[model samples]
Target: EEASKIVTPNNQSQLEINGGTYATDSWTNVTPKILTHLGMNKHLQQDHPLSIIRQRIVNYFYAAYRNQRGNPLFSVYDKLNPVVTVQQNFDNLLIPSDHVSRQKSDCYYINEQHLLRAHTTAHQVELISGGLDNFLVVGEVYRRDEIDSTHYPVFHQADAVRLVTKDKLFERNPGLELFEETWTGSIANPKRILPSSKFMDQTKQPCHTLEAVKLMEHEMKHVLVGLTKDLFGPRIKYRWVDTYFPFTQPSWELEIYFKDNWLEVLGCGIMRHEILQHAGVHQSIGYAFGLGLERLAMILFDIPDIRLFWSNDSGFLSQFSEQDLQKLTKYKPISHYPQCTNDLSFWLPPDVEVNEGFSPNDFYDLVRSVAGDVVEQISLVDKFKHPKTGKSSVCFRIVYRHMERTMTQAEVNEIHKNIADASVEQFNVQIR
Candidate 1:
C-alpha cells in the first residue's frame, strides 16, 4: 500500500493552481505531470545556472543603452501571469485556428479559451497594448514537447521585443558598436522572412518603412549575435538558420556548435504588423526573439541532459555559485545506472482509427503518470495499418532508468506490469 502510494502522487493531489476557477472539463491536455511543473521556476533560484544566464543576458541589455535616452534598452517582465487566454497565446499572435501549434498535442489547454503559455511571446500583444515599447519577458513556458536529452514539458524562455517608431528610426542609425562584421548574409541576400502556407490571413503587413525595417533587423541580429558570443565566448562557432513562427516574419534561429552538433538556442524575426496594430502600436518597426535557457545552459555548463536541471541532487546543484555568472563548470556524472527497455504494441480503437483522436502526448502523459521521471524516453518504434481489419497498429519503446541508482530487474518488471495494465484500463488500448 505504501509503495503504491509512493508511485501515485497525482491521485491524491488534484487541486488547481491559484488565480482561476476551472470547470471540471476545462483542461484537455494538462495532466498532473505537467501541472506539477506549474510552480517550479528553475530560473528563480539564486544558485541556478538558468537564473545566472538570464542575468548575464539582462546585464548586456542594460549596459548597452545605459547612457542613452529611454535608457535600460530593455525592461524585464519576469512576473507576468503564466495562464493566458487563447486569444493572447494563439489568436493575438496571428496563429490560424487550424494551426498545428494550437493543437492539444503541442499546447497545454486549460480549456478551449485558456491555457498555460507555450511561449513567453504570449505576453507580447498585452504588453504593447498596455503601452510598453522596448522590453524583455522571461517566464516559465509549457509545451507538450517530446521527451529527449534536450527537451522537457516545462522550460524557461526569455522573450525580447524592441520597437522603434518611424521617428525614432529616423533619429537612430542602424550602426551599433557591438555589431562586428560577423553577419552571414550580405546586403543583397538578407534573411528571408517567408510566410507559412498554413496561415490563412495576411502574410506581409508593412508596419514600418522598408529602411526602418532593415535597420531594426540589423540591430536585432547584432544584439543576438553579441549576446551569444558573450555567453559562449568568441571561439564558439554558430550560424543562423531560416525558420517559421506564426508571430514573426522571416524568422531565423541561432544555433551554436556544441558537442559535435548544432544546438538551436533562440528564434527571432521581425514582428508581424498586424500583431502590433492589434496592440494599438502602429507605424513602428520592431524585432522579437524567444530563447530556450535550458539549451543555452546545457552547452555552457557542459551538462549532458535536460533532466539534471530539475534534479535535487546536491552533487548537481552545489557545483555552481550564484554570484559568479561567468563560471563555466563541467558537470561530473554521479551515477552510471543501467537503463531498462520495454516495448508495448497495441491496435488503435475505432475512435482513434476514424477520428485520429490519439496523440503521442496522451501516451507520454500516461507513462509519466505511472513512472514519473524514471521513464526517460518514449519513442514510436513502429506503426502500420492493417488492410484486413482496417485498424492501425503501433509499437512504443519506453526507456526506463533511475538517474541516481540502479534498479533491480524485479522492480522494473513490477513497474512494467503497472504500465501495461494502465494502457489497457485507462487508454482502452488493445495490448498485444
Candidate 2:
C-alpha cells in the first residue's frame, strides 16, 4: 500500500496545523514544503533516532537530579506547538523590539501577532506562569535559513530551565543550603565566566547578588557537564566557550570534539532575573539552556547530512532503532548524483562597502525562494576592483543537486535564469 498524502489548504489566507487555525497574512514566509513538516512530531515518534536521542538526554538529567538533589525529574513537554505570539517568542525573552531576527526574511509570521516558534525557549515563560519551576520542552523550531547539508528551515531544540533560590529551597525542604564561594576571575576563564557583550550588562538583574549568581552559575555548569558526559560517554573531549543570548546572562556554549572539530552542542547560562520575575517567581534566580539535538544526533549516529532525518527511505533510516541508544550506526550513501554549477557576477554600488547590500545570505534566500530545495551549495568564487570606475565586482558559484534523484539541465537553466534576474531586480546591481 502507498503512504497517505497530506491535503494542503488551497487558501493562502490561513494555515491549519494540529487543529489550530492561524490567520495568515502577507508576511507569511513559510513555504508549502515547510508546511508539510508541521505536526510530524518526529522527536516524539517511536523509533525515530532524534526522538530516541532526546529521551536519552532526558534520562541522564532525570537520574542526576533524582540521585544528587533528592528531587524528581522535570516534566517533559514534547509536541508540535508551531503557533506562538510575538511577545512569547521575542518580547518575553527581552529581545529588542527591532532585532534583525524579527525580520520577515528570517522568521515565519502568521500576521503581526503570531508566528511559528523559532526556538523552544519561546514556551519558557508560559510554563513558568503555569507554576512549573523545572521542565524540558522539546519541539520543532522554524527559520528561513540557507539551504545546505547542515542548514534547514525547520529543526528541533531542547530547552530546559530551573528556578532556584535559597529561600525557596529552605521553604520546601529546610535542608538545602547555598554554597558560599563566588567566582572571582577574569572573563577569559571559561569555567568561571561566560562570554560577555554590552547586552549582558544591560540585562543583568539589580536584585541579583554576586554570591547568589555565582552559586547559581556553578550549579548550572555542574548539571550540564554531568548530562553531557552521560550522553557522549564519560571521556568525551569537550570545551566551554563564552556566547550571548537575549534571555540569559553570561551565556556559554558547549562544544564537543567530534570529527576532529569542535562542534557546538548547546547554549546556556544564568537565566535573566527579569524572565523569572515576569513568570511570577519573584524570590528566585534560575539558569536555562537550549541545545540543538540534531547536531548531537548527527555526531552520535554518524548521520552524514541533516536532511536524512526527514527521509522516508527505509534504506537510510532502517539503520537506527529505538531499542538501541549506544549503537553507533554509520550511515552509508545510497547513491551519488551528478552536480550542476552556475555562476553570476555583479557590480557593487558606490554608496556602501564591497560586501554590503546583496549579501551571500540574501542571495541564498533568493535562490531557495526560486529553486526550492534542489539547489545545494553557493560560494563566492571571484572578486575584482575596477581601477577607473572605483567600483568592485564579485562572482558567486551556485551548485545544484538533488539528494534522492537527478535534475534535468533545462530545469537547472530555468532556475539559474530566475536567480540572475531576481538578483538584478531585487538588489539593484548590474550584471557583469
Candidate 3:
C-alpha cells in the first residue's frame, strides 16, 4: 500500500530520459530505501550492531561467512549448489510428469516454470557428478503446508551427500585415515578419491542386514555426534530411530534427547537411483540425508518455536550461548572407529496416528520426544505388503549408541521399551 502511494521521483527521473513522466516526489537516493527496510524489520534494528561502511563486528560476520564457505564441513557453502532459493527447480533430478509429488497438495507448482521445493534432496542431485564423491549442503527450503507446533510452510534443511560404492557404506575404509585436519582436528578425505569397490559389488548386498546397516548407520550418526561433541565439549544423550522419506530406500531419522524428552534432529538414507541419474552421477553408490534445520536450532538452543530462527529478534539471536558459539568454533579429535548398522522392520497399520489429535509425524515425534537418547538412528527399510496381517507394513532400521560408553543389549532394550510404549499408548501402533 505504501509503495504505490509513495511515488519515486528518483526512479521517475531515470525514466524521464526514456520518455516517462517525472513523479511529484521520490527519495532521490536509494540508500534510504535499504535503511528503511532494515529499520522496518520486526526487531532487527533493535540492539543490532550498527551498520556502517566498515566495522570490526561486520568484518567478523563477513569473515565468518567466507571461512564457513571455504570449509568443506560447511556443506551450505557447496560451490556446485551455489545456495539457491527453495522454490527454484533443481537443475537435473529427473521429474516424472505424472509423479504424485507434482500435485499441488504434495508440492507447490507456480505456473509452468516454478514450484516450492518439497525437499533438499536436490542438493544431493546438484552436487554429485560421476567423478566426485562426498559433500553436504545447508539452506532454507519452502513447502506449502499448514503451520502448527511442528509443521511450517518455510523451513531450513541440511542435505548431506556422499558418493561411494555401496560397499563403502558397510566396511571401514583404511584410507579414511587422511582426515586429520577436518573439523574434528582429524584428517578426513585428504583427497576426494573414493574406494572403487563401493558401487559394483559391495552395495548390492542389503544394508538391511544387522551387520551391514550398522556400519552405514554409524558413519551417518557420527556426522552429527561428532559435530555435537566438538561443540559441546563432552557427552550428550542421543539415538536414532526408523523414519520415513521418499528419497532414501533405507532411510533413518537421527534424534537427540533433550530436556527430559527425545527430539528428532536429522534424516538419513541411501540415495535412490533416479536421484543419482538426475545429478548425472553414474557408477557410484550414494548415501544421502536431509532434515529441517529449524528443528536442529531448536534442539541445540532449546528454542520452542520453529519460527524463532527467523524471528529477526536480536534478543532471540543474542540468546545463543557463548558455549554454543564455542561449540560452533571449537575443534575435536576425528573419530576413526568403524560404524555398525542394523535393520529391523515391524508390522504397522498405515492408519496409525501418534496421538489422539495429532498426525503421523506428530506421533513419530512424540516417540522421539520420549526415546531420542537411546536410538542413535532410524530408517525405513521396507514398506507396502504386510506378510502376516496383510495390512501395510512399514519397516524401520534402528541404530543405537552412547557417547559416554558403548551400549549393552539390556540397556538398549530398556530405551527401546520407552519408544515402544510411546508407539503403543499414544498411537496404538505396533512394532514387529
Give per-residue CA lDDT, model 2, range 214-258, as digits (tens).
Answer: 667778888888888777779999888977787787688998888
Model 1: what TM-score?
0.87
TM-score of every model versus the real structure = 0.87, 0.79, 0.45
Winning model by TM-score: 1
On the 0 to 100 scale, the lDDT of residue 169 in model 3 is 50
CA shift at 364, candidate 3, in angstroms? 24
Provide the global lDDT of candidate 2 against the true structure. Answer: 0.75
- On lDDT, the leading prediction is 1
> How many residue pairs clash in model 3?
41
Q: Arrange candidates by lDDT, descending.
A: 1, 2, 3
Which segments of candidate 2 are over 4 A away from where they belong?
Answer: 1-26, 67-71, 167-196, 199-205, 344-366, 380-396, 406-411, 414-432
lDDT of 1 by residue, 1-432 (tens): 323333233353233655566543435557666777766777777788788788888988887655356567678988887888899898888776778888877888766777899999999998898888889998889988777777778889999888876556666554332112342322211123434645423223333345555677788888899998898898889998877787787578999888789888899988876677677775566789999988888888878888888888888888877767777777778867899998989888854752286778767777776787888888999988888887888898988888888988898888877777777766577888
Per-residue CA lDDT of model 3 for 68-174, tens digit only, reads: 34643223332222222222343343333444555544443322333334566665554565344655454445444433445544455656676555444534544
Q: Sorted by TM-score, highest first, which candidate order results?
A: 1, 2, 3
Error of 1 at 25 (Å): 3.2
Q: Which 10-residue window in model 3 sums to the lowest lDDT?
A: 48-57
